[model samples]
Target: MSKIRVAVFGCGAIAQRRHIPEYASNPNVELVAFADPNKQRAEEVAAEYGGKAYENYEDILKNEKLDAVSVCTPNYLHAPMTIAAANAGLHVLVEKPMAVTAEEGEQMIEAAAKNNVYLMVGHNQRLMPPHVKAKEILESGRLGRVLTFRTSFGHPGPEGWSLDGRDSWFFRKDEALMGAMGDLGVHKSDFIRYLLNDEVVEVAGFIGTIHKEDTDVDDNATCIVRMKSGAIGTLMASWTHYKGGDNGTVLWCENGVVKIGTGQGDEVIVELTNGTVETYKVGAMATNEKQVPSGVIDDFVQSIITKTPPTISGEEGLRSLKVILGAFESQDTGSIVKL
Candidate 1:
């Protein structure tokens, strides 16, 4: 079997810690090139993966031989990079918050379609075993039509991951857009939507900067969602939580509740209507290490090979982005916004 030739833009933490490592270990992919504005960073990461470095992403796109490219840039760069890669006839696995705005996301979707290329969003939560199990149980009606859902995803500030620390592009309105909602809110919105198989029809929400002093963007946000299925839900995302509990999602259905964490070695807990509760530890359930996988990239590779829709396609990313954007609109106008 021939390996898929791939290039990666943005040699940042997510790319270093997850993307590169995952692709490095996958025999089906050939890591061909790396691109980042910072030459040294790109060179270091590329050296580890046995790839060449390009100071400009265009250099990689100019290569006619690559089959796919991973867009791992900041939130703002997602759309333009993905569209460019697609136009270059390369499949794209873009990082989450597909774009800062829904319009941009649509452009990405259109570009992928026009180019006849695969476009997948890197929402790795969908690949977690507990989350996978939750999707299965929820779909099987063991949860009995998710009536209400409340989920939150938060962490300490992006000091470790973001390049600029507290003054990172993440805190800049022009580069990061709406802060907490875009960074964490959208992820939860997407995860819940995938697990419950429902769309948010309306949202009444608020965004604020409860912490992270001197920053213009919101560090905390909460929103109430009206799902298309007539179910109600609430979501919170923040960087203000001092202790940093990490990401967590909870679904309340007619029968019971299910909860999962965003960290490694975590388990999924279930509570049934009869008051019988069970906690299915991920490692115990899967007979493998309980950690996030580069399954998103693996799935993207398969989608490109088989001409199939990725589990988290660009269109799916747009829908999830809509909820978060709607939340911002709701907060600004003090009114419920329809999807």
Candidate 2:
């Protein structure tokens, strides 16, 4: 089998940390091209990873013969890049918060379907080891039904992580669309939905730029969500956790509770009504401070090889994105918005 030729559309923090490295590590993939507005960044990535660097992504799409492309650009560019890639007959693996709006997400999906190519979204939280184990436990019916839960993803902003530091496009509303919610909240929303095997039906939340200075986008967001299965929970995202980061989730179930990404040593801790306690050292989660193999790149490659839809397909991405959009609408109207 020929190696899947791949291009990365952004050479920023995410591309350098996750997409580029993962794609390079995949034996079945070839790093063929890189595109970024920063010519130096793109050239550096290309020099290190073996690819042609392009100042414009359109050049790569029009000129490169590639099997797939990773759309690791800003939130605003996800839709356009994916659409163009799909139209070019290349499979797309797009980063999270799939697009700025539901309509854009739908268009991306349509383009992929029309072109008969895979469209995968980078909702990698579901693939986290602890979260995977938690889902297994929930599916085993050991925790009965999840009644309510709380999940959060927070850190001391993206300044330290982004390549551009504090001035990164993440802080700009025009580029990021929604700040903390788009960056972190969407991950939690998709995660909870995946864990419960349910969909968010309604959402109400408070989102604002609480601490970050001179940023129009929200630095923090807290939402109450009602799932279609009648499960209710709070979803929180913040870029103002000065001390450290939190990617913890606690589920209150009918029979007991499942705690994930909380314990110091154990990645998952379960306490049952029958007094049975189980602790799992599944693995460490990928954080802004620590980089881990997300399993997303491998999955994307395998899906193309096997000619199957990605686990996190475009439709699934759209579903998860709608939850974030609903929260934003909720914030705007000060009322519960239905998904």
Candidate 3:
């Protein structure tokens, strides 16, 4: 089997920690190029990760002969870069917050389809072992129908994660777009949407910059959602968990409540209404301090090689982003926004 020629369009934290490393480790992938505005950083990664560095993504799309590319840039650049790569006939695996707007995401989807290339969003939560287990339990319907749920994804902010620290693009509104909502909440939106196999039909949310000092975007946010299955849920994202982080979900069903990422040492704990309890060891969520290799890059490469659609397709990203976009609208309008 021939290796898939691949390139990374950003050389930052996500690229370094997940995409580049994972791609390098994938036997089917031949890491060929790296692109970044900072030529030096790109060169540094290229030297270690086995790729030629280019300062501009356009250069890579225009010149390289590659089968796939990973768009790991800031939230704002996701759609444009992915569209360009697709138009150039390269498959894409882009990071979350697919685009600033669903319309932009649509353009990306259209480009990928028009060019007959695959577009996969990096909704890595779908690949989390605990989340996979949760999906299985929910599908069993052992707890009956899901009635309500609550999920949270937060950290100390991206400062520690980014190489630039406090000076990272995450603190800049124009670059990062929104804060915790985009950085963290979007992940919950994707995961929750997947777990329930339902779409959020309406959203009522509160977004704020209450905690972070001098930040133009919100550092904290919470949204109440009504899903198509008639399930009502609360989704929250924050950067102000000064004490620690709460990245987990709790589902309340007619027969029981299933908790994923809640208990210590037990990532998944399911409690039935009958008073029976169960604990699952599906592995822990990836943390900044102790990160795990994600399956995103490998899946993207395999989808291209197998001529199959990616699980987290461009459409999936657009659909999940709709809930987040609606939440922003609801926050601004002080009322519920229907999808």
Candidate 4:
């Protein structure tokens, strides 16, 4: 079988540092080309990976015999790029949060379905070993019924992480669509949904730009959710959690509770009503062991070969986006928004 040809549509830090290396080393994939609006950055990444560089992403879509493309562009570009790739008959692996809005995410899903191509979202947290174990544990029914939960993802604002520091789209409402909620809250929202196997039906939230200056979006946000299953949750997502403590998921259930974090390799720690604390560890993809990001990329490639839907499909991505948007709506109205 011919290795699946892959092209990355952004030479930003994420593409160059993670996606390119993962694709270049995957046995079943060939790193074929790259595209970026910035010519020099695109050329640099392309040269580093032994691939061709195109200033315009359309160039790669029009010419390469690519089986898939990783839409590694910024938050706003995610929808357009994924839709284009799908319409061109290429499987799309979009970076997290799906897109800025549920409507946009729906369009991406529609395009993929219309063209008969796969559309997967890169919610890499779902691919992490610890998170994997947590999901399995919850599914095993050992925790009984979940009553409430809390999850978070944060880092000192994306100053160094983004292409431009404070001036980046991350701080701009027009480009990012939402602040911390879209950036990190959605990951937790997805994790919670996956863990509980429920759709969030209502939300009450507080969204604000508490820390950053001259930013149009929130730097800090908090939300309380009511799931369809009647379980409730409190979530905090911010770019200001630079103090860094136990930053992961915690579920409170009728039987006991489950705590997930990086301290135990992101393992799931379960405490039962019987006063027993058990830990379960989820293993990583061997070739990319010790590296969590590769698991997502590897799965994306495997989905293309197996003609399977990725664990985080485009529809699932939209569900996650809906949660985030609900939080925003809740914030705007200062009332519980029902899904």
Candidate 5:
């Protein structure tokens, strides 16, 4: 079969670090074009990775012979870009928090459906090997029914992660929308939902901007969720953990507790009520400076080649996004929100 002609939209940190490199490595993909409002970034990526660069993303859709494109733009732009790319008959691998608004997410999902293209979201936490193993254990009923859980993803902030440092779009409400909730909390929501095979039914949350100076978006966000199975969980996303970053989850279950991303290695530790502890080594989580492709890109390419649906479909992204946006509503009202 011929390679899937691919272009990358938005030449930001994610595009340069993940999408571009991963697609370059995938034998099934042919790098055709790159685009960003900042023509320099796109030109740089194209120079290193072999592609034509365009300042206007529309040019890629109009000119490139592409089967897929990864949408690595800011949060607010995800829906429009995904919709446009899908409408162009190109499969899309979009960043997480699929859209800033659930309504936008729905529109993106509908666009993909109408255009007959695959739309995948970059909730890469689920691709962490331990997370994959955790899902397996939960699905096998090895941990019994989930009772409650706590999951968190925290780090110093995008100042350390984004290419533009503190001046990055991530700090602006006009650009990135909400901060940690959209950035990390949404990822955790999706991760927990996948790990438990359940959906968030309700949310109670607190969103704040206690850390970053001159930043309008929330730097910290915490939410409690009730799952469809009557399981309750706490989800947290923070960009002010000055001490150290922790990305992990602990699930208390009827038979035992599933501890994920815990300890030295990327291990999922299962502790039974009977005091039996079993640890499974999956793989290490990626960091900003030392990131590798999170398997999302690989899965996307394979799904296209096999004529299969993406595992993290646009609808899947919407469900997770609902929890985050619902968290915002809960925070605003200081009450519970039913998803």
Candidate 6:
């Protein structure tokens, strides 16, 4: 394919902020179509990006001659849309929390494999500059094995970012599945796994809707995760951080402590046990106020063009989702859930 013809399945906040713009900017991608339930939103995106507007996503899958699609729809729609696109012989780059249930994630993966297409999940935390640097440091064996860690991703809420404002589907249980945990927790879970190169084997947490009104889903969650290597850490997600956002991770290792995304300008800070301090000035983390290229779109497009599996594959997404699900089970049962 000369230029991978791409269509966006949702014209909402994530599509506008990340997917469409990145695809348009990518020299290897030709963004060809946009689909959304809201016709006007789709039309506006198409007008800006030079594509056809589609009100129904099925129409795009049926009519468009596309090589790939970014499934940027709500959480509930991710599995079905990706399965459909894969069945149509198109590669899929789906948003985080790949599906509502593990079964759905498995089905999406099966569809992609059966159709012989790439299925990438948008777990963009691993693409952040600070996170990339931190991973490198850990791999060097300088940190000597992480003992304990804490990673958090929080903001005021999706209301400030979602196109639907306070009434966004992010707060709906049916559409979003889980609120703060699904939106923010999964990112941290995936990040922790990437940083440690280990799976989260056990999860115990307290997840609830503490502050948000008129929402059945949780507004805050605090999970204690134990990795396969016996490293324990805390993973927190909050939509009620009214003051400001915190996307920071701190890993206390045998040799030193590595801090990521905690500094104002410096993105990574390392404090050694032998009284040495090192800092890195990687770029800022993407936030609602300031959007940056997440690198997910480029990775997905390149994987399709090169006929290779994406960095964040469907199985990786499913693993991250399983962590969040285990946390939910722990919350419900008041006992540690084993993954």
What is the C-alpha local distance difference test score of candidate 3? 0.90
Compared with the true structure, model 6 gives a TM-score of: 0.99
In model 1, which runs have C-alpha deviations exceeding 4 angstroms?
262-265, 284-291
Tens-digit lDDT string for candidate 3 (1-339): 888999999899999999988988888889999999999999999889777999999998788889889999999999889988988888989999899898899999999999999999999989888989999999997989999999998888888899889888899999988889988899999999999999999999999998788779899999999999999999999998876688789999999999998877237898887889999998877877777867788788889888999989999999999889899999999999999
Q: Pick the candidate with the highest lDDT.
A: 2
lDDT of 4 by residue, 1-339 (tens): 999999899887667667888888889998889998888988888777777989998889888898899988778999999988888899999888789878898899999999999998877777677777887888899888899888877777777677667767777777777787887888888878887789999988898999888887888888999999999989888888666633577889999998888445456789999999897766642111133455778988888889888879999999988888988888888889998
Q: Would you list the C-alpha lDDT of every candidate in the order shown? A: 0.82, 0.93, 0.90, 0.82, 0.90, 0.93
Candidate 2's TM-score reads 0.99
Question: Per-residue lDDT tens digits of candidate 6, residues 179-212?
Answer: 9999999999999998899999999989999989
| lDDT per residue (tens digit) for residues 177-227 in model 2 | 899999999999999989999999999989999888998999999999999
lDDT of 4 at 211: 82
RMSD of each: 2.8, 0.8, 1.0, 2.6, 1.0, 0.9
Tens digit of per-residue lDDT, candidate 1, span 1-339: 788999989987778767888888887899999998988989998777788998899987876379999998888898889989999988999988999888899999999999999889887777777778878777787778888878887777676557667667787878777787877788889988888788899999888887687678888988999899999988999887667556677788888988775434367788898988877766422111233564777788888778787879888999999998898889899999999
Of models 2 and 3, which has the larger TM-score? 2
TM-score on alpha carbons, each prediction? 0.93, 0.99, 0.98, 0.94, 0.98, 0.99
| Global lDDT of model 6 | 0.93
Worst 10 residues of 5 by lDDT: 284-293
Candidate 1 TM-score over all chains jointly? 0.93
Candidate 4 vs candidate 5, TM-score winner: 5
| Cα-based RMSD of candidate 6 | 0.9
